[model samples]
Target: MSLQFHNQLTHRVDTFTPQIEGKVSLYTCGPTVYNYLHVGNWTAYIYWDTLIRVLQANGLRVERVMNITDVGHLVSDADEGEDKLEKGARREGKTAWDIASFYTDDFIKGMARLHLLTPQHIIKATSYITEQLELVRTLQKKGFTYQIDDGIYFDTSKFPSYGHFAGLDLDAQKAGARVEFNPQKKNPVDFALWKFTPQGETRDMEWETPIDLLEPIVADGLEYEQANKKMGFPGWHLECSAMAMTLLGKTLDIHTGGIDHIPVHHTNEIAQSEAATGVTFAHYWLHNNHLKVNGTKISKSLGNGYTLNGLGEKGYSPLDFRLFVLQRHYRSEGNFTFENLESAKNRLHNWRNSAALRHQTHDRLRDDDEKSTDDESVSLYASSQALIEAISNDLDTPAACAIIDEAFRKIDGINLEDIHQHALTSFIETVDNLLGLALFDTSKDISDDIKRLIIERERAREKKDWQAADRLRDQIEKSGVTVRDTAHGSIWEYVA
Candidate 1:
């Protein structure tokens, strides 16, 4: 089946067609890197990682870029507040550069724990100031930019289709803003492309604003402070366009972020980039819906923004949260609770147990006279193909998960002697490849000593010697393996 995705730009599910056949250029909005990411923030990353996996599974070579916003992201997500990195520095009593480095390292560690695929390029916004400034200069030359007292701004009035992507009503926005809007801005929707540092204050992450990019009025007027060496920074929306174009090209196959970006951040990116390049910024746009905690919005004041470390303290691994996120469709809003997370944890535990069956499948089949069993035996090969089909259809991860559950249920019903070891191992590989749950890494055969103890325990149970059976079970538990005596036989699992 062909790939399909619900394109936010078109407001419909469109079949995917890369600009170049068999090659995809993708961009994902990354973390701001001022603090540890909450589970809500990690949801987008996991989903996009699955997108990369599915693209590869469909024989497409993906050249992806993810940015780390170390500078210029404001507290308000607009141009009106303090930069997040500088705010983080004040909170932690460290330099803005140091705060970015520390949190960026933490984000990478979290990605490893979650088993996410790394992008081909992980560029930091601070590293590309010159490129960002060049983009602003291009806009300035194209007459799409104007200067106000605070910064250089993009004129939404110049872009006729500025609000088309989000279906925004500019006239209504202007009417709503009559009471408390920036008096200097020409339109209510005009956004900053670059912001100048206030005259009396210095920023930890400022760069010299190019004199040529500044307006003649601002550069020549004596009222402007520090005009010869003005320090400023790129707007939050500017870096993504600049970095994506610099690495990928003028156009991209896919661009992904949270739904909140559509109205402001992404809309502004489209206006500025297409205005500068005279082409569509991205062919397809994918936005994941927000993740709520306990049916409430995740807020700092609520203290409900649980980080990976916080979940670890509660004995939930990153993979458990990953599975929880995948259970819901990406376009649907997800409500997260500890209770819901526990269910996903148990589900992963069961999957690992099923994966452990591969090791025992060979042993059980070796004793049978025929190497293969009945014609009705389960075919994981067909299941693997079905799994890809579900994912290819707009990243239907929930459906794909249901398919896995059904396949595992079939394996559970059949006798162990009938399970094909090679097919089962291949299925496990597909699961790890598509879902990144790391089943193969987590599930393994028990030590031979533990296996012998299980044999003795089985013998004792066959003879109805309950005390000896109990003793052997205790010995097996000491080695961190638990035994479940089903009617079929004894099954061993790790105690994690």
Candidate 2:
């Protein structure tokens, strides 16, 4: 079966046929290193993670790249807001670079805890300064850029398809009628390529450009006194365009980000990239819906979102939240609440306990000499085969989740020795490889001592020592291993 996805570019939901056979190249806009990543940011990543897992499970080799926007991202998509990194610096009392370094490490650690597979390539915008300048030069030479009081601006009016992805009327875009219209822009939709550092201002993070220090030339719908030669910064949109060109070449297979990116950030990327390359920028465009809480967005400024450290301190395992995210599709917005998270946790614990039960049943078979595989092994094998079918069908994750849940519930019904072995092994290996659930990792394997305690707990239950068994389970859990009780046996997993 072939993979399928809803392509925003064509406005059609179609099968995901890659440009190259058996290999998929994808680029997701990663979080800007402004502060610790909030749960909202994580939902996007988790969505992408599921997509990658589903693709890999369908036997498609994926080459994924996620960009780290350490610089050139503004608090406002209108290109008139404060730099997010600079804001982080002000909040942390450190340099922008330091903040980027600090939080990037934190983000990586969070993903590790969640068992999210890292991208094949991580491109940082700050590191691509030379590349950014060259791309701007390319646009300049191509007659796509014009000098404005604010620095170089990409003349969105020049591109007939300026609002191509945005599905906005070109006339409405040019009329200064949109939100946050700057009176000084020649066209309301024109966006900054490079910002000339404001004159006479000592910016801690200014770069000297090779452009001439000249007097201001043009004015706009509304303007005041400002020179184009003053040192500023690179505008947000140009950074992604330049970085995407450098890493994925002039064209990309797919470009992904939050739905919020569709109107401005991604719109400008298409303008600049296609203007320079004279071709379509990306074949498919995928956007993840927001992870909203209480019908509003989660942002650091609002103090409404949770970071990994914050969630971890509250005793929520990172993967539990990751599993929570998988309950919905990438294009679907997921609700956030303590109730939902608790429900997801229970589901994960129950699944683990079922696996443990299967393992114990296998052990009993080994001892009985009648020779049969456990219920889990059989159920997993059946589920693994269905996993591919679900994933290939536009990554039907919710369906796959249901199938997995059913397998967990029906493990007891599977009893054939040879059949059970084949099914269980197949299920654990294939679905694990696809979902990135870390079910069979050597490092994640439970220690023997904890396993022994878990088995003892099981035996205690068998002996009808209910209180003692519960106490033993608690003790084992307090030792940093989580215990899950199943019909077949008790199982434990190490917590980080």
Candidate 3:
């Protein structure tokens, strides 16, 4: 089957076709780098990473760009709070640039620990300031931008389809607007493209607001204090559009982010970008749902925003957490609890043991035996193909995982010598490539000394020396290898 995804733009599961055949241009909304990312913040990244893997598995060359919002992203989506980086600086007693640098490094390290594929171009929003200004200029030239006291704002009224993508009720938003709303805005749903620094206060991150963008301002909102070069910065929505179009082109094959971005952030991206280029900003938009903690929304006030380090502190590796994330579909809201995580950890442990079987069976299947395939041989080969197909159908990770579980169940029932060595190895490789679980790396062969101990234990068991066999089993486990004495034979598994 061809690749498919629930395209949020179309609001349906659509077949994925790239703008250019065999080449996919993907843009994923990256972290704001204000602090260490919590599990809730990381779900989108992991989901998008899976999308990249699935695309490559389908034989498509994916050129992906992810944005690091080192600047312009505000504490509030309403564009009324401090820049997240600046706030992080104040909280950590560092400069905004220093905060961005530190958190960006932490984010990258976390991605590595989770085995996420690095995007081809991970651009920082600060690096594309000039490009962002050019986009604002384009919007201004097209008569799609207006200036207020705060900054340059997109004229949502001019773009009649502004709320169409998000299905936003502009009339309701305007009618229910609070009295404290910014009356200077032309429309209640209008968003900032650039934000000016408040008067009498300097900021750690600010840029010059071009004079041309300041002209044609509102009658009551025109005030320039810096010799026609007011200090400002790009809006949170502006950076993604600028960086995405500048790197990926005017249109993208796929754009992905959390579901929360639909109403404000992504809708504005569509508005400002399409108004500038007169074309669809992205062909497909994919959104992953939120992750909650113990059935509550992840919140710092609730102290449920668990970071990767937090999970590591509790003795769960990043891969274990990755398996936890993939246990449910990406579009499904996941509930995070230690109990749930323990289940994923155990599942991963079982898969690692199954992965170890390949090391035992390698180089043992005869050529003649390969010609006469057994049920186990066909099962392993078919399981690998089924995994790809399941993931291709809108990234059905849970289904793909179930397929592996079924194949491993069969492998568990049969004799180790009867296993198909070549098919088993290919199946493990497929699991690693598609899931990024690094099963092979974790399931290495035991040392020669440990192998000898296992042999001694087997000999003791054959002679019915129960005491001696128990002693040898203890010795084998000391080396982090535990032997499972099955009816077929003993299988070695990693202890932790």
Best by lDDT: 1
Query: On residues 48-143, what C-alpha lDDT tens digit does candidate 3 reach at each position?
Result: 888899999999999999999999988877678889899999999999999999999999999999999999999999999999999999999999
Q: Which has the better lDDT: candidate 1, or candidate 3?
A: 1
State residue 476's C-alpha deviation in candidate 2, in Å.
Answer: 7.8
Over 14-86, each residue of candidate 1 has an lDDT whose tens digit, in order, gives 9999999999999999999999899999999999999999999999999999999999999988777889999
State the lDDT at 403 in candidate 3.
95
Candidate 1 pairs with clashing backbones: none
Give all TM-scores, in the order shown.
Answer: 0.96, 0.85, 0.96
Clashing pairs in 2: 4-16, 183-222, 196-230, 196-231, 196-232, 197-230, 197-231, 197-232, 377-424, 381-423
After TM-score superposition, what is the CA distance of residue 184 in candidate 2 from its true location, in Å? 3.2
The local lDDT score (0 to 100) that residue 346 gets in candidate 2 is 79
Residues 1-496, candidate 2, lDDT per residue (tens digit)? Answer: 7667888788888877778888877888888887888888888887778788877767778888888888778777667777888888998899888998998888888778877889988878777777777778888887778776557788887888888688978675456466545667668778888877665665556675545423344766434334233566677788888777777777778788889999888889899989999988888888888888766778658777888778778778787788788888777887887788888877776665444443433333544534444444545666788887886676677787898888766664344332354555456566566666655552244567877887788889889999989898788878777765545344455443
- What lDDT score is found at residue 471 in candidate 3? 96
Supply the global lDDT for candidate 1.
0.91
